[model samples]
Target: MELAAGNLSEGNASGPKPPAPEPRPLYGIDVENFITLVLFGLIFAFGVLGNSLVITVLARSKPGKPRSTTNLFILNLSIADLAYLLFCIPFQATVYALPTWVLGAFICRFTHYFFTVSMLVSIFTLAAMSVDRYVAIVHLRRSSSLRVSRNTLLGLGFIWALSIAMASPVAYHYSLFHLEVSNQTFCWEQWPNQGHKKAYVVCTFVFGYLLPLLLICFCYAKEIRDDQKSFYSFMPNGQSLRGCVPFIRCHTMIKNCSIIQFLNNHKVN
Candidate 1:
């Protein structure tokens, strides 16, 4: 009886407890580093060249004053892209190459803020450009009479302000953290013990991805619909309208016929 009790106690004590798994390094870290380097180089080269050209043209062009609102928006967009390339790219490239952030907490926080602000600015500028294109193409008459210069400037100001506001959290929350197992450093947001990390991810995706995508889609759809309407208005009898096509026929057939006719006419010459 004593031997059985001892064996039973040993068995109970030996019952499985979860073993700590070996820590694994993040996947694709090397590939990500290479990509970051390439992107940084390209961004630096093109951003500097393109932005310089924009500024030079805007400054020297004597087109009897800037009549188009698009010029201003393009100039602003280039400036934002250049700023991001110059300020953010180098730091990001360094982080990727080293795979460890040796920078102090303050620098990390400030750099993160700059990166986020520039990204937000770029996205918002693209959104503004989409709106500008939609207005120009879809509401040509109304666009002509609009005081676009003043409104565009105001819009740019608002975009920058909003971008700064969105990026403030990075400056506030980012910190340099050391992981002993990996023996590497990371610059990440230091959230409260609660579910702050999840909240941040959700917010980032909603504002950064979802909202921008929806805005771009809405603007593009409007532009396409307006273009189709304009084409039908100019066409005789609206026979060329795409909606008139029978559902059973392939759309490519119509496109192929037009191409074949063009080719035949050219060959005859």
Candidate 2:
């Protein structure tokens, strides 16, 4: 009697007839993509505008004007920054928006190669400039001969050569990563041997970070010891370590920031 009563009360009484509701796939704004786009866009825009202005100012000089070694380095630095801004940021933004690497392999290799090279060149040039500034203040008399020898241009050429050597590996190793689950692609480096990746990363760290910091310190220490007091040294404590500390701290901060930005964007693991 109870079983008959139960069957009568329920709509489906053949078996366990009520089915679980299937979950609906979410369709909404992806916060990660949105944030990435916003940040990348601002960086791209500002980099282009600022670097372009720097390049232009350095490139166009008065008819009788001669550029200083610092100006030359500043010019090179601007060029590198400009190239990085043009090559990496836009394409990176492209991939973030797209589902895959639709532009194909040639660009996949060259874009990253150029970007890496430019970043290296920028960091190197900045370090070179710090050294040049040290020379100017400490050895102003000798700098006249260095200026005549066109050492700045020569140094710039050397920096570019070294940068290319450091960045060339990207051409061979970087490619699109196809994520099976999401059916999406990412630009990444896949090293054939893990040792190669480790070596490359270590090299980048030492050359890009450690060496630059050391150079900045050496330059500033030389500057402090020159004993060439200037009008700017108004305060007795003005020429102290606190004043010169920024040369080490700030310059390293810039180098570390640049290298970190490149490595972060590269997604190098």
Top-lDDT candidate index: 2
Query: Model 1: per-residue lDDT, tens digit, 133-180?
Result: 677667877876563678888988999998899768668877888999
- Best prediction by TM-score: 2
Candidate 2 local lDDT, 1-269, one digit each (tens): 99988888774656576689755423333567767888989988887897788789779877875675655776787777777778777877776666678777778888888877876787787778668767666777776666542778888999999989988888989887778998876777789887878788878878866787689778867876775463123222233324433433553465567777766754545
Alpha-carbon runs more than 4 Å astray in model 2? 1-29, 177-183, 228-255, 262-269
| lDDT of model 2, residue 45 | 88
Provide TM-scores for the models. 0.64, 0.76
Which lDDT values do the candidates have, in the order given?
A: 0.65, 0.72
Poorest lDDT segment (10 consecutive residues) of candidate 1 = 247-256
